[model samples]
Target chain A: MSGIYSERHTLEKTESASETANEPVKKGDTAEVKESVAVNKMRTEFAALAVNEAFARAAAAAFFSRLDPTVEELTEIKTAVSEAVSNAVIHGYQGGSADKTVVMECEYENSGIIKIAVSDCGVGIKDVEEARRPLFTTGDAEERSGMGFTVMESFMDRVAVESEEGKGTRVTLIKSLDISYYGV
Target chain B: MKTEFEITDNILIAKLSGEIDHHEAADIRSDIDGTYAAFKKKHIIMDFSGVSFVDSSGIGVIMGRYKKTAENGGITAICGCSEYLRSILYMAGIFTIVKEAKNKEDAVKLVKRLEAAESGEIFQEEKEAE
Candidate 1:
């Protein structure tokens, strides 16, 4: 079943989130007593366009949170990816081609960092510098947010976007997991 | 991924199991539209009981579906929302478009009443009196 709707996600291995490491096992301790909490993880893809952006972001957020990302950390990752995926949809698929689909892969890194990679196969970005600029879009009718890359920079610790005009675009973002908020 | 939809009385409930993201949205949209079309139910309730994480993209799915339901003169409600999900929903203004209930039972009741009013099963004057 989809993890999107429930928090009681079952897993293969069990280890509690560091947050649970603090409290003593007092008699009245009624906190979630599960021996270990597993990081929730999800991986999926979407066809390029406005339609798929939201779903991609939501699923990625859920999956990444399992690594114990802070609220701020997660938000930054979401914004960066949202722009990249949106670009893929608007710039890649919207160009009117038969093959459509943007690939997304996310991994939780060992140092509590979440790594997200988004790649597309449609028309590539010819001028990487211009595309990265705030409020710059090749499209006319669909009022571009132009702030796509800007939002990404604001939210993520690292964002590397590589593109070629005729090829495709790949954007990667990484952020460290902040466990202190959870008192881990 | 497996998705389930059912109608109990006048309420339409959809349970989405699996990850909900862009890649899965079209299928989800099709599933939801097909379910609503088949039941012809007036009130729509989505059980987020199984959803673990959601982003703006997921918000688009809910908003898009809500528009479709609203076009049919029906209302949409949500239930079993996690606090994490609720924060995103609130920021996206989902509460402005549809009502949310505490659980599936509460949702069914709310939608049924809306259906009753639409179908004239509940006397308008009597409903006002109560």
Candidate 2:
């Protein structure tokens, strides 16, 4: 089961903004404030498998570790990640289709904010709004509780879904951190 | 996730350990539901002390068992959940029907109480006769 999803992920891109604070201030002159900005981004692909749900959550938690999120925050992120990945694996692929891949993207900013996007190039949702409703699931009632989107909305600061019928679906989740909690 | 089940006095005690996600939900659900059916237990007590994480799929597993047990005039109780896990379960509106406990012993007592209440046996026969 574990072999269905690949662990190899690339650190696709990295961007850093650095400013030197070497400017001498003169009397009656305004001094420029030097600011540094760091952006971290990563993208990974996984097979549409039920077992990879754990792998997605673990990967997201590790990516957000640099922000030093609290236990609650960490769990929230993990839950959201799990939901998104599960949706991709179960609904998007509509079975254990190993040929398709679910992609996960993680972005971190120095501004104490993290944005994650889970996308699948599989059968897209026909009605995203209806699907987002609580207790709205297309899967078997005996198997699904239909609270995936509800859980994601509750755990994340912001949630959005973009999908096209027959193309695929993309779920974007953003969370703002209280840097003070982690003393970051 | 791994689940261990013990039956005593018609109560099914399920001790779940490890992380519960979509990957583990199916197996765990089958195991719990299968055991609960085979034994005809009157109540279920889920111990979450060993659980470190749970996702929405986990809720499906929990709700399925609760619904099945409720259908048979049985009650479901969960115990030993961390604050994080409790909050997640709470947000999912599981508390509307399910009960929570601090420990395994309290959970057993809760299930017993619920069972009695379900059977209208909480009040003594003399009280009811009066």
lDDT of every predicted structure (CA atoms): 0.64, 0.77
lDDT by residue for model 1 (A1-184), tens: 1221112222211113223334443333324552222232445676556656666777787887666676766766776677678777867666423357788877653335556778887788878788777556675412232555655665666666767677887776655567532213
* Model 1: DockQ vs. true structure: 0.06
User: What's the TM for chain B in candidate 2?
Assistant: 0.88
Q: How would the docking of model 1 be graded?
A: incorrect
Using DockQ as the measure, the top candidate is 2
- Which regions in candidate 2 have their CA more than 4 angstroms from the true location? A1-38, A180-184, B122-130
lDDT of 2 by residue, B1-130 (tens): 5699988687899999999888887788888988998998878888989988888776777788888888988888899988877777776788887888999887877777666776788733332210
Q: How many clashing residue pairs, candidate 1? A: 28
Model 2 achieves a DockQ score of 0.62
User: What DockQ do the predictions score, one after another?
Assistant: 0.06, 0.62
Fnat of each prediction, in sequence: 0.07, 0.76
